[model samples]
Target: MNLIETTYQLNQKAKHIAKVVSVDNATMTNIQLRAGEDIVEHSSKNDAFIIVRKGKIRFIVEGEPVVVTPENMLHMIPLEKHDLHAIEDTDLILIQIKP
Candidate 1:
């Protein structure tokens, strides 16, 4: 079994922050955002899974707004337009898999 720690310090001075945590069979990324910061609408070529690790985030998927908390997650299908807004200081993991 592989164990990893996802703890990270938020860069309050930056509008957005992201880093690759691990990658092999798939790509895993750690993304952090301060309240009011957001990722602009975009689409991925691959499917993706997002897990809220610290706070809350609002995901606008295909023109629908969905609020996700630490206890919940969001999945994005390939080519789906989506955007993310930090409702509070938030940390999340994004796993992407090529189809």
Candidate 2:
């Protein structure tokens, strides 16, 4: 059996990004951001599923605003443009599936 630790420290006034898993078809990344942090507009080449584990984030996807929280997730198709703004100290798991 294999196990991976994905815990991250919260409340820090900094942005932390780490790749926790990588395989033939997919990858998982952990992103932790302090309140007021923002990820500038960008696009992904692969399909993406973002799981919000803690706090909240405001996502601008294709110019549309979407509020994501631990209550729900966000998904984007390949080449979709998006940006993220941390509404509070946030932690998220980003999964990308390659074609």
Candidate 3:
């Protein structure tokens, strides 16, 4: 078995991303963003599940904005247009699964 760390580090001031796990059909990515940082709109060919580990984010899907926090997770279907803006210092994990 293998182990991976999925925690946030304090005092993070810039956008950070790391791919912690990858296999034939899926991947797990860790993303950290400071307040006001954003990811430009894009679409993924694979289905995506986003889990907010800390703080909050404004997740825009197809031009609709949804606030995401640690209490809930977000899922996006394959090829859906989306983008994210960090409402505050945020840490999240993104899991993508191939069709």
| Local accuracy of candidate 2 as per-residue lDDT tens digits, 1-99 | 569887776644488999999999999999999989999999989999999999999999999999999999999999889999999999999999999
- Model 3: residue 45 alpha-carbon error in angstroms: 0.2
lDDT of 1 by residue, 1-99 (tens): 667766566754554455565566578888888888889999999899999888899999999999988888988899999998999988888998876
Candidate 1: stretches off by over 4 Å: 1-5, 11-16, 22-24
Cα lDDT for residue 49, candidate 2: 97
**Of models 1 and 2, which has the larger TM-score?**
2
Error of 2 at 58 (Å): 0.6
Give lDDT: candidate 1, residue 37: 89
Task: Name the regions of candidate 2 deviating beyond 4 angstroms.
Answer: 11-13
Residue-pair clash count for candidate 2: 0
- Evaluate model 1: give its lDDT: 0.83
Q: Per model, how many backbone clashes are there?
A: 0, 0, 0
| Best of the candidates, lDDT | 2
Residue 31 alpha-carbon offset, candidate 2, angstroms: 0.1
Q: How much is 42 displaced in model 1, in angstroms?
A: 0.6
What value does the lDDT take at residue 67 in candidate 1? 94
* Residue 96 miss distance in model 2 (angstroms): 0.3
